[model samples]
Target: WLVKKTPDRYEVKIPARIFHEYVAFMRARINKGMGVAEDAIWSAATECLFLTSSARTKKDIEDNIEREVIGKTIGKFRNKYRSALRYGILDSAPDIDVLLLAKEIDAAVVANDFGIQKWAEELGVRFVPAKTFPLMLKEYLKQRSSISHSTKSDFFDDFEES
Candidate 1:
């Protein structure tokens, strides 16, 4: 969270694996007696998820294991979260889609995979670990939700010197 962008408002580049991890983390938090909102979890899904077209298809296959083998509805839960990425940028990859988006938008990549880290370092892309993102994001949203519209200035005014 100490990392800051040159532009104040920016998108984050999320790998599909990290996106799935986020959904599982959110589900675990809710199921483990944490008072997390479903929308908060889904909103995270909507915010930064990204994948190559091939990875997206592969992810669906991974998520279908329970449904296909165990006659369970895990795929339904996964599908709900996956649908949130319909508007996500679908690029081609050697898992370079995250790097490409991060470079394009000067955005940070939310990922923890060693391969992604290696590529990001080689490309000079900024990154944050996936493990900390959920708490950081929840806090950010909490602060944002507390802002009073009447007291707020125009979006660009936020960049002005106080």
Candidate 2:
């Protein structure tokens, strides 16, 4: 079976948190002289869109506290157990940023955070496990290299015949 080629326009959207995590992981691999890590880093540099979400403003802090404390308290009294339980699932500003950026760009999220994965699914965003990202990048780069090599060989063959 033939596999479809990845589109040239395909882009990877990454939040700052994931970007840092990926960079650190790749750096370690690169220091060890892993060829796949080299390819992955190059791909990330070219295809990944690194984005930073806004900082948690005063209002956001207040809202979080309200949700964690007052909301949970009210939820328990009102028999809304699920709402109370949801308070800490997305515990940080960076987590929310990942969801927001993915939703805005209609891109898949690569993150290990279970909370992010759960919420991404709820928002109809695609999710890719962080663990497999490097492997995927390696495969993509291999395919790209093979295609380029074949194209170059075919060009040389045509030139020789002419």
Candidate 3:
């Protein structure tokens, strides 16, 4: 598969728990009749690179659940969320993993995760806003185009792509 073989294009990272959560979310979305290209999801997971924060990150995610639901009247989803937040299982994060991925890889994060976007600014990570991607995409594409401008030695530096 392209993802497994070549991670250069779509580098991604996630807390171990959040990774599983993404799987469950994907499952629920499909079950609930949300339409998505399966290949895209699979690529985002299997092909994209992944990472995790400390264990406290998982606890941070669990602690936020009640307040999160209180806002949404998310009645039945509570326990499911805790279980999902259990480390290395679901989309739990002290901060969202997608944002962490953006920070780690310096890649333009393709997500509408406002939570992550908020933290990303604080962390000084650049994010490609999901909803406004088309408007920003010309710049994003321009960045991509310059990828090859870096010679092999320069591309491998520790400073990150940006």
Choose the strongest candidate by TM-score. Answer: 2
Candidate 3, 1-162: lDDT as tens digits: 455555653357545566546766755764343223333443343322222323343334333543463323333344455445443322334445665577678866655656566656765788666778886778888887777666655867745765
Regions of model 2 farther than 4 Å from truth? 1-88
The candidate that wins on lDDT is: 2
Each candidate structure's TM-score, on Cα atoms with residue i matched to residue i, is 0.34, 0.45, 0.29
lDDT-better candidate, 1 vs 2: 2
Ten residues in sequence with the least summed lDDT for candidate 1: 85-94
lDDT against the true structure, per candidate, is: 0.55, 0.64, 0.52
- Kindly report the root-mean-square deviation of model 3 from the true structure over all alpha carbons: 22.6
For each candidate in turn, give its C-alpha RMSD to the true structure in angstroms. Answer: 21.5, 23.9, 22.6
Residue 2 lDDT (model 1): 95
Model 3 Cα shift for residue 53 (angstroms): 54
Ranking by lDDT: 2, 1, 3
